[model samples]
Structures are given as C-alpha cells and as structure tokens.
Target: MATIGRFVVSVVGAGEGHNGRRTAAVARALAFISALIAFAIAGLMIFDAVRVVNEPIEPDQVDFRLVTGVMLVIMAAIVAPLGVLNLIGARLLGRRKPRGRTSVLTGSLLGAVVAFMVGADAPVVVWVSVIVLFIVTAVAAALPGTKRWVRGAPSPSESGELVLGGVG
Candidate 1:
C-alpha cells in the first residue's frame, strides 16, 4: 500500500517532467523577448529626448520637455500595468504545476485585441505586443513543480478493506 501511494505520486509528477524542461526554456526565452522590447522602447525614448533637447527652441519646433514628459507618462501608464501583470504571471508560473496555457494565451490575446482595437494603434505594435505576451504566458504555464511523492500506509476502510487515501 505504501509503495502504491508513492508510485501514484511519482507517476503524476513525472508525467510532465520531460515536457517541463522544454516548456520552461520556452518561457525564459519569451521573457527575454519581452525584456528586449522594453529595452528598445526605452532606448528610442532616450534618443528622441536627446534630439529634441538639442534642437533650437522655436515656436514650430516640438517642446522637448513636453514631448519627453508625455512619452514618459504614456510609457509609465502602460508599462506599469504590464510589469504588474508580469509579476503576477511569474508568481503563478512559480508554482509547481502551473495551470492551463490556454487561459494565459487567450487572456493575453483578448487584452491586446481589446486594448489596441479601441486605442486604434498601429497594426504591428498591437500584433507584436499581443503575440509576445501570449507566448510568454503560454510558456510560463509549463514550468515544473516538486517531484517528490511522500509514501503513506493505506488506511483500513469501514468495509474492512484497505483504502488508499479515502479512495478505493
């Protein structure tokens, strides 16, 4: 009976072990992509800032401060939320057997679609953003959990038969 309990646990954990490595690697890769995007955005903003600041202040010329400030505000508004979401997702995937990848992918897609659809943003921006988030979320769900299965003795049932954790 004890051997049976241990075996059951081992079976459950090992079932996904092989797949877990590949999936986890994919998640890390997607996360790297997200970081890259964020870096690119930040870099562009910085370049734009320098260009505007060096330009002579003319009425027709764009206000560097205003432009930079607006850019910062927009970046903060959107990136902050994404950062939060990433944190939540990282935490969830931190678990041993993360939930369905479908939910994560569907959610990211729905969010990107609705946000960009209403915002009327560029096609590439919206699509890339959605796809990237989808990939990240999907990969994160395949991370592994604790692989140990504690052995336990079977308990005697009221019917006078050995029962395994309340199951026959």
Candidate 2:
C-alpha cells in the first residue's frame, strides 16, 4: 500500500522541489481525470440517445421519444468538445505551458456549468461532487504557485541567489 501510494505521488509530481510545480501537477491530474469522466459521460449520453431513438414507440409517444433523444444528443455534443478541451489543457499543462492554465480554467468553468445544467436528475451527492471537482480543479489552476510554475518562473531560492549575485 505504501509503495503504491509513493508511486502515485511520484507520478503526480508531488515530489517536485517547489509547491507551485506540485500544485500545477495536481491541477493537471485533476483536469485529465475530469476530461476522462466527461468523455465517458458523453459516450453514455450518445448511447442512450441512440437507444431512445431506435426503441419502438407508440404513435402518441413519438414526440416524447424524439425530444428526449434530441436532448441527449445535444448534451453529448456540448460535453464531448469540452472533454477534448480539457484533454488538451491537461497535456499542455503537463508541458508547463502558460496557456495550459487558461485552457484548463476555461474548461473547468464550462464543465461545471454543463454539469449543473445536465445533472438535474442526478442524486444530490453525485451532482455536488462533480461540481466540487470542477471547482477544485479551477482553484488549483488559478493559484499563484501554479501560475508561477506554468509561467516557468524559477523558485524563490533560485531567483534570490541569482538576483543577488550570490555571496559565495
């Protein structure tokens, strides 16, 4: 268990020298996970929409089926692109690009909106958890430390020594 925990920490970049980089790494992981979840949800939405459209329906229920299927398809359309954005953001963040933070922030905000809009029928706990996940991801990406890290600023210790011309 300890070994697995250590491995997870290492993979997440938690062992890095600076807090900024560590937080940025965490944001990247969260964004990546959120993107995967969004993709899965989008896939399920597409599948459900197809199933609804193909299922046998009584004449009076035709409108109901059509509306439900169309709604699901629309939701899927919204989610899949956001998922792609999140994936791109996560990849760029892993590379320490400044724009990665912007992308991730945008994706996180949009994702939270979509979750709130589409999760009306979901269990309260589940819906809230999804919202919380988005919020946390946004907060992590927006942190000062994360911003500095993504901008490629040297850590304080490194900066101070260089700026002061090093006492020897």
The prediction achieving the highest lDDT against the true structure is 2
Q: Which is the leading candidate under TM-score?
A: 2
10 residues in a row with least lDDT, candidate 2: 159-168
Model 1 per-residue lDDT tens digits across residues 55-146: 67779855667666566556535543443344344344333223323333334444444345433444777656655565545435433422
Local distance difference test, candidate 1:
0.45
Question: With candidate 1 superimposed using the best TM-score fit, by how many Å does residue 80's alpha carbon deviate from the native?
Answer: 7.5
Q: Candidate 2's residue-wise lDDT over 1-168, tens digit each?
A: 999988855644455565577788889999998899889889989999999888887776435777899999999999988888888999989877877888999999999999999988889998899888888888878877778788785555665544455452
Residue 92, candidate 2: alpha-carbon lDDT: 88
Model 2 alpha-carbon drift over 4 Å, by segment:
1-19, 59-62, 153-168
Alpha carbon lDDT of each predicted model: 0.45, 0.83
What are the RMSD figures for all models against the true structure?
A: 12.5, 7.9
Point out the worst 10-residue segment of candidate 1 by lDDT.
Answer: 145-154
